[model samples]
Target: MPEKVKTDLGFADLQCRKSDVGRISRIAKAAYSFNRRFFGKEIKKPFHIIICYSRKEFDDIWGAETDAWLTGFATKTGTIVSFRDDLIRKYNPRKEATLAGTLRHEINHIFYFQIYGSYEPAWLLEGLTLQPPFEPFTLMENDKKRLKGPLPHLIYSTNGKTFFKQAPFLYSMAFLATRH
Candidate 1:
């Protein structure tokens, strides 16, 4: 059970430590703005943002084993939970991961869910989540022979247990597929 924290923002209800509340609120606000700009529309729904400070906290909230590579998640349009970037950086030391990007990616999920009611073809969902400054596109990264191999089917079709087997390639390929 997590304690709820009050936030004076209209876009989201934030729950985190006193030290992180402001930063998370700011990032969330900025991410929502980016989403609004990307979608070229305005959304007024209030969402929840939970900042988890440890792997145990995140796993407890998730009620299962989450991928070690992921830093955050948008459980649905109404809520998102993220691990502290600094605490999780060890998992993505070379991946250029950041707290801002995680929030942006997760919030995009909420924005799209509001629009399409449900985002399908996990590739599109995953792809759309990787907007500029959030998860930049790269042709390929080193040690990614999985990309050279036959690309996995759409991201959703792949079982969640193995969804991140080749995440780097999946994200890159998804970005390419969704890029206009």
Candidate 2:
């Protein structure tokens, strides 16, 4: 179970094991700060946040079958951010930073949906969502072969079903295109 943390923007909650409270709190604070600066007002409804301590916990809660590589996602109601505790312990030193960025990114999705409604074009919606400073390029960082073509064509062909797989490339391209 998690405890409620009061914030000016909206309803905030944290769910993690006792060992993770401090780190998760810091991420939450940063996210709230970003929301305050970007949106300039409290969101019309409460925003709930859940920090899963491990990928297993995340999969169990969401009924997902795979080891989660995507990190986080958001819907109208809330955002779920996951940290791979085992991987963090053994491999990634920047896990917390990644967690913070993912939270910001996912929360932005919720914020944009609330303000614009869900009917916005995918390119515009994703571009606006990526407005916050984070490494959108990191998704395709290692895929040199995939980076060779006309990006817009690839982006235009993607639909909701394929969006998740193509999001990293599409999001970066959309962000670059829309930011100007």
Candidate 3:
């Protein structure tokens, strides 16, 4: 197994396994490429991303940060991403969700950091970042069951912070909002 160390927000570690390293590298590159196209110009700085395989390593690297439920985090210094070996072993034995979801999700956060230096409103930032023209956003097609088609108008009338509490509700709204 690859080593992981605790960091301020989660785990901090390097990806050493050939396959894991390759996957992270590929996704990070895709994130950068997507950001460049979204902005219509190349972002000059290179991103530094750190990965960890276990909660202990994540806690060790995360140090004393208080927020819980943080599966991963992105900062200017680097991005810390976490995944449980148990989850992989029990559920995603094939590694599909690891690459398709966590990898892309955190990397998109990194790209958002580069695009907007300060923490923007969670709604605008998360909404725009999670929406289309982004590569990972396109992967939503693969999870059809998760999509509840054509959200009700009442959902969009509410604030993002409120609706997002119910992720399925928020996703339906997102789909509705993005459409013409």
Candidate 4:
């Protein structure tokens, strides 16, 4: 249903249904703008997106490779898969918001690599990056939705050991720590 667009870059490619172009473009632009605002300048990077009709289609697109190597990767070395998408027909009608979150999250990884030479600790990267005060989510309808909350069980460390055990809870706690 969607047409394929190949850029001169030869690396990035996208396929989308005829109706989704405007929506997808707007999502990408907003993500780009958000990144530009917090980080001092805009970055022009090659991003390839496939508009999937279903979650199966998304999975297929995700598994496709550049040559033979997998085109995807997880943010963590031990975590084999980098990104995952769930197509919620009803709950996920907000594609633009979804796209915005995905782009911002992944792009933050690249930004950190540029600065620190590699992804820092999960707590540091995810902790600070999750800072909504820095770049808030696009789904907010009012001040309440835009509101920031506390992270409940966060534990910080100069060394990585303590933080990785209960990363999720720790990150949540860390986020709360920043608020208070």
Candidate 5:
């Protein structure tokens, strides 16, 4: 198949493996609608969403600072980089409950960046992304263990590289902080 199939999803211009077009499109649409209503702002310009079919592809795009465990992430310029849900499901059962919200979480980061600008604290950015109206926010056993450690590592992270380097631990705490 072609490396990627391109399509316009109204709010986003997507590029993905031919097989991911349908599934990614659905998630992107839901993410767009959720962000629009939750943030009370619409992405006026069409942003980009790139879905990688495998870990090598994702790592190639991510390059330096690539975290082995991240399912998806957003850039400051309004882009979402991710694996399709099937790929995520096979490798990371821990993230299963939040699989459908991966795009939404990335979209949430985009909205957060758009509204707050860059340099906002990573905890706030991550915490808010895991907040309600997007996904049901479930925690697995691994998540529970992270809560036992000192939080400075999770709370002090100020960039994606640092936050995602410890994403497995940080994301769970981030969600817990925002669950109210």
Candidate 6:
């Protein structure tokens, strides 16, 4: 088992396995830089970043059987990022980019939650968070395709099962509408 290490970024704090310190730091730096450049400042409130080293660890901590498909998520208070050690050991040039992207996505959620004081549509939330081409106000081919489907009118009160079931399509549509 790997030992845990924690680093404070002032605006955010990171806790991850010792072996993953360098990668987590790089991701944090990139996320902070991106937020500063675009948002004009660091996040207004401090948040926690918990990084798990394996699927089991992530599930255990989050209490969700995310099945490794979810690399991370954010809440009003913080973000959770995961990197399966076995997966990282494999050669992949895009790994860092993916991690940084996830961090950026989560950070945007936290920022928006604080600023708006209420949750926005999933598409708007994710679109704003996703990287360029899918950035806040930009539309992509997928977003256009998603617009043709049934769209959710309200963002609240949907049951958990229904919300999870419709998440992918609904978020895509929301992103398209936001762009428009």
Per-model TM-score on C-alpha atoms: 0.83, 0.70, 0.54, 0.51, 0.83, 0.74
Q: Please give the range of 10 consecutive residues that has the lowest summed lDDT in model 3.
A: 4-13
In angstroms, how far off is 105's CA in candidate 3?
3.0
lDDT tens digits by residue: candidate 2, 35-132: 65787866666666766665676667666654334556675555555553454433342344366666676667777777777725666766665664
What is the per-residue lDDT of model 3 for residues 25-105, given as tens digits with 9 covering 90 to 100? 555566556655666665445554565565566667667442343455565575545553344334342344444355455
Best by lDDT: 1
Off by over 4 Å in 3: 2-14, 64-69, 84-97, 133-180
In candidate 1, which residue pairs get closer than 3 Å at backbone N, Cα or C atoms, i.e. clash? none
Taking every candidate in turn, the Cα RMSD to the unseen true structure, in Å, is: 2.8, 4.4, 7.1, 8.7, 2.6, 4.4
Which consecutive 10 residues in model 5 have the weakest lDDT in total?
151-160
* Best TM-score among the predictions, by candidate number: 1
* Worst ten in a row by lDDT for model 1: 137-146
**How do the residues 51-152 of candidate 1 rate in per-residue lDDT, one tens digit apiece?**
887788888987887778767877654788887778657665446777788888888888888888775666788888765656775555443566678765
lDDT per residue for candidate 5 within 1-180, as digits (tens), equals 477778998878999777778877787788788888898887665689987777887777777645556677777777788777677765556555444678778888888777777636666777887667666667877677666666535465545466555667666767876665
The positional error of residue 3 in candidate 4, measured at the CA in angstroms, is 5.0
Error of 5 at 126 (Å): 1.1
Question: After best superposition, candidate 5 residue 61: deviation in angstroms?
Answer: 0.6
Candidate 4, superposed: residue stretches over 4 Å from native: 1-15, 60-97, 134-174, 177-180
Output the lDDT of residue 161, model 5. Answer: 62
**Model 6 root-mean-square deviation:** 4.4
Ordered from best to worst TM-score, the candidate numbers read: 1, 5, 6, 2, 3, 4
Candidate lDDT scores, in order, read 0.74, 0.60, 0.49, 0.45, 0.72, 0.63
TM-score of the candidate numbered 6?
0.74
